[model samples]
Target: MRRSKNRGFGIALGVAIGTSVGVAVNQVAVSIAIGIVVGLIFGSILDKRSQQQEK
Candidate 1:
């Protein structure tokens, strides 16, 4: 399946960061949650920027 351009960066980055933190702290779930939230913030910012560029 094709990846989504809008969300791909944030999600990938989030997961990577999250997994790293989680593994380091031994709190997989919490780390993943934090990562996902951060990723969503990043994704939203990116998406808004892209939309602005298109206009």
Candidate 2:
């Protein structure tokens, strides 16, 4: 449960960061693209961390 929550938080954080970066850069397409990339990166990081913790 806590792990799930952390993952969600990480995703949300990624999206927020991506959106902010997009807005700052002044491009909607770039913002959405960045958001997805950031989300994936966050997800991967979280997955790796979880695996490490499990080991």
* TM-scores of all predicted structures: 0.78, 0.64
Poorest stretch of ten by lDDT in candidate 1: 1-10
lDDT of 2 by residue, 1-55 (tens): 7566666777678778878777887886777676767776777788788889999
lDDT of 1 by residue, 1-55 (tens): 1225657788779978998999999999998888888888888888888778879
Clashes in each model (backbone N, CA, C under 3 Å)?
A: 0, 0
- Candidate 1 global lDDT: 0.82
Clashes (candidate 2):
0
Which candidate's lDDT is highest?
1
Evaluated with TM-score, which candidate comes out highest? 1
